[model samples]
Target: MGNTDKFEMIANIYDTSERIQIAKASSDAIREYLVEANSKNAIDFGCGTGLVGMNLLNDFNSMLFLDTSQNMINQIKQKISDFNIQNADTLCFDFEKEGLSDLRADYIFMAQVLLHISDVELVLSKLFDVLNEGGHLLIVDFDKNEKVVSDIVHNGFNQAKLTDIMTKIGYRNIQSKTFYNGSKIFMGHDASMFILDSQK
Candidate 1:
């Protein structure tokens, strides 16, 4: 199967775990990075199944959830239905594409999505462009040393590479730390968090 096909096949399983306690904590950490933002508009890029949206629904006044896979967005639509979403919408978007040219947001978020695309710098540039001045970007994914995902399709990337990419992209005072808790992606026996937060 192709990359998207594989994700589509497994998307249901991902949505089913949306409210799990551990996942809630994981999502909370990422959301905390944005809660204090000056603006209420936020975009969750690569918002697969809207897990990030589910965690953040109560915080943002408006949110745009974007993903490349239509099936995954469908899964998110269903999964987030139970939440009290004040304002939320989903779109099929590839960040660097022309269609997203005018889509600027006060805050841009990406988690569990970067490793899928190899053009890390290009993707970051797109996110940077969409942010309002003084906006922030929060990212949570696997660190480079997490070898369990080495052979997996579109797994998290190395921590150092992320640091370099963010600095080169003109991000400021980037901060990152590893979270050693287990993750279902690694069969619940892996350290799953290395978070990065940067400014535009």
Candidate 2:
């Protein structure tokens, strides 16, 4: 089954306090590197249940919450309706199999989404195409953790290697730092989360 299928089953129960806390932290990290967000359109790529994107709605003029699972999109849509969020929208999309659409954004942020992508370079390239010139791409994901091996997801990522990959994909001004360290955060093992900021 695809990752979307796995996430579909958990969409209704995805917003536990732990996840909310993590999303808040990730949003805070992204906020630190943000520039002129109020004038920019942003995309919360792979946004699940709108946890992080919902918290960041006020920062951007408009926010697009994109995810692969329709159920997750439904959950986010419900939250949008319940909160009367006027500046946010939702799209159920899969970057892996789909060609680049007309979608474009001034800022693109992905929280804990890179680990699930099997072809990281392809997705990054597609995201690059989706970004407006000089747009920023912020990625929040776990640092390398050798102890946490899995078949469906990466153990974590090496910041330097990731920067190299992003650089190759044509992203500039790449900067990354570990911002949150939590116990049992990655595959039931202690892991540190890093935020990467890159410009297109």
Q: How high is the CA lDDT of each candidate model?
A: 0.71, 0.93
Residues 1-200 of candidate 2: C-alpha lDDT, one tens digit per residue: 13888999999999999999999999999999989899999999999898899889999999999999999999999998998999998888889998767999999999999999999999999999999999999999999999997899988899999999999999999999999999888888999999999999
Model 2 RMSD to the real structure? 1.0
Model 1: how far residue 97 lies from native, Å? 5.3
Highest-lDDT candidate = 2
- Each candidate's number of clashing pairs is 2, 0
How much does each candidate deviate from the true structure in C-alpha RMSD? 3.0, 1.0
- Which pairs in model 1 have colliding backbones? 144-158, 144-159
Over 1-200, each residue of candidate 1 has an lDDT whose tens digit, in order, gives 12466677777776554335545766677765765653478888887777766677667778888887788888777755755455888888665454456887877777666766666788888788888888888887766544554444455667777789888888887888776456555434355667788888
lDDT of 1: 0.71
TM-score of each: 0.83, 0.98
Deviating ranges (above 4 Å) for candidate 2:
none
Return the clash pairs for model 2, or none: none
- Candidate 2 lowest-lDDT run of ten: 1-10
Which residues of candidate 1, in runs, are more than 4 Å off? 16-22, 79-84, 96-99, 149-155, 187-189
